[model samples]
Target: MKIGIGSTNLAKIEAVQRVFSENDEIISVRVPSGVSDQPFSDEETIEGAIQRAKKALETTNADLGIGLEGGVTETPYGLMLCNWGALYSKTDHSPIIAGGARILLPDEISERLRTGEELGPIMDDYCMRENIRHHEGAIGIFTNGLITRGEMFSHVVRMLKGQFIYRMNG
Candidate 1:
């Protein structure tokens, strides 16, 4: 099957690649999230994922499209970093949505996020490294590498794929 992923980011792409079979053709394309760069709510983040999935499917004209989005949502305790994944199937006009892990952001990061700063750049600066988002991600830094950005998103993709298979079979 031909699958298109709605991001050029290596971590997100790696997440999808880890879930799908080797026989499937994976196409990575940069697509707009159709939302704020730093989505601040669960609703916005999921919307971004769905939009990316649909846009990627259209852009690549593939049978399926996948989207992964990372954002922060405000919780009672603090701002929490959240990740979401979506799969859109052209044949059935169906979509499977799943979410991964969430970690409370430190005050320093939350404070910067509230100032309209994006997490990727903040994490990069905080880690004193470049392209952390494309690699380990904030979750990795927070978890001390226990859960990487790609791994978290890959878990979500696994859920999405499993659910999609169930739906197809039923």
Candidate 2:
């Protein structure tokens, strides 16, 4: 089966690669999330993932398209890190959706995000590393490397794959 994944971000692509079979050909195509560069809410973030999956499916004409999106949302506990994933297929009008773990952000990082600065650059400067988003990502940094961004998204993709399989069978 041919799979197309939206976005060229290594972390997102890696997640899809980890969940799908080696027999399935996975390719990355750059596509817009159709939302804010930094999604500030769960609704927006999920919408972005869905858009990416739909666009990738159409763009590549692949049997399946995957989208993984990371963002932050405010909560009573604190602003938290959130990631969402979507699996879109030709036979289904609605895509399979799933979400990964959420970790509370430090007040310092949350402060920066509230000011309208994106998390990618904020994390880069906080860690003094460039392109952290494509690497370990905010989840990795916040979790002290215990939970990687790839692993988090991988779990989400696995859920998407399972649901899609069930959807087809049932």
**Predicted model with the maximum lDDT:** 1
Model 1 per-residue lDDT tens digits across residues 1-170: 99999999999999989999999999999999999999999989999999999999999999899989999999999999998988999876867899989999999999999999999999888988999999989999999999999999999999999998999899
Candidate 2 achieves a global lDDT of 0.92
RMSD to native, candidate 2: 0.7
Candidate 1 stretches with Cα past 4 Å from truth are: none
TM-score of each: 0.98, 0.98
lDDT of every predicted structure (CA atoms): 0.93, 0.92
Which residue pairs of candidate 2 clash? none
Clashes of each: 0, 0
User: What is the clash count of model 2?
Assistant: 0
- Tens digits of lDDT, candidate 2, 90-130: 88988899998999999999999999999999999999989
Q: CA shift at 3, candidate 1, in angstroms?
A: 0.5
